[model samples]
Target: MPGKPNPVARLFWTAAIGCPFGLWYGPPAFAATGLALTLVLMRHLGRPRRFRARVRRIARAHAETLALRRRQESFSDAYGNRIEDGWLRERAYFLDRTVLPQIGPRFADLAESERNRMLAIVEAEAAAVALPEEDEAPGDGIDYERYCAERLARAGWRAHRTPPSGDQGADIVAVRDGLRLIVQCKRLAKPVGNAAVQEAAAALRYWAGDRAAVVSNAGFTPAARRLAAATGVLLLHHDALDDIDLAGAHRS
Candidate 1:
């Protein structure tokens, strides 16, 4: 397709065409030509600004997509086998292969400040997806449940600890965007077992929740992970709670 007309070139052509008519005719002709030129100028005046705004919106949307991909990849790795420096390597590869190629050309016309601002937006989004540093477990399982609830609350979920004794299998119940998540929290030295996964899955049905998850300070046993996969129960590190997508969990 042919490219759009250059504003400067269009202005020059308009003036070139109108000048002779104005000279050949009288004041009325001159007034009409000037009005036409003004209208043309007004039409193109905001084109660059609008184009830049569109580019910024595209950049932000791509940044958000990259963040989501990173979170999903991290979640998968944490579930199965976590590799050292995996996230850093994955992020570098994504920026080099995906983000730069897609957004780089669109940014060519943007001013330095605007370009920098978009880059900052991308970095901020990526940082948000980076998992929180591991923290010491809370004093007891109840404290850990409360801690997870607080973390979920910060992430926009209305989360609270379930009642102690007869709360079924759910240690925490969180609701967000009309999705209810039943979580079984385990503060353990050993890997969480199949029982936790079983409880979380059962709790989801018993509590009429949209999704179920088992959050733990320790890793999950292979059997528990398999059971969770079969039951559509999320096996998450407590640190991963902030990045959970309630809708995605429900679908899973």
Candidate 2:
């Protein structure tokens, strides 16, 4: 495989081609050949760089395409599972079978190391593609709270739902590894705001818990994130309940 075209080699070829035409057609032909050579050099010199950029664009497109197809398939399944994990798992296979064929011919003359570098670019770009977020939550707020509690229980936490009324802003109370956590569950179409963060922080103090978190199906507002950060409260996606780090949560 060939490496990038050398500048000296390009100049040599330009002269080789132009000299013959110049000899036959005088100074006019020589000047025209020089101009054409300049344009060719300008464009062809960046071929490798342009090719790498093209590879990144193609990789992202292929990744998004695969994610969309997986999401569509998930709609028909009983669980309505998230497609992000599946997309990541199948990324390499999809790239080899679909993405490579479209761009592989261009890399035919690249050195093995250069080819590997290009593949690395493709992998990074594909990995950077954002998968669609899981938007569907349970039917109502109470169910959503219960759902979060159940997920925490499965993750080895001793978790239970608080009473529907007079719970003092805590939807769930979870304990694991000698740390008690107060969680406020919010299931809303819109993003959770600073009020939820405030509520969770207050609940943590009220319950005398070590840590506090606000778990939501929808994302949190910027204000909420800022408030959570200031109050040492965690604003989390529901999926993150599975891997709660008790010691880490207390420190943070």
lDDT for model 2, please. Answer: 0.71
lDDT of 1 by residue, 26-88 (tens): 788888888888988987776556655554455456665556444433422334655323234
Residues 1-252, model 2: lDDT tens digits: 354456667778888999899999999989988987887788776767777776677777666655443442222222554424323334555556665577566554542435666557655765566776854558588989888998999899999898888888999999998899999998765657899888899999988999999887656666876787788898776766878765463211
List the candidates' TM-scores in order: 0.48, 0.52
**Superposition-based RMSD of candidate 2 using all C-alpha atoms, in angstroms:** 11.3
- Clashing pairs counted in every model: 0, 0
Predictions in order: lDDT = 0.69, 0.71
Q: Which runs in model 2 stand beyond 4 Å of their true positions? A: 1-136, 246-252
TM-score winner: 2
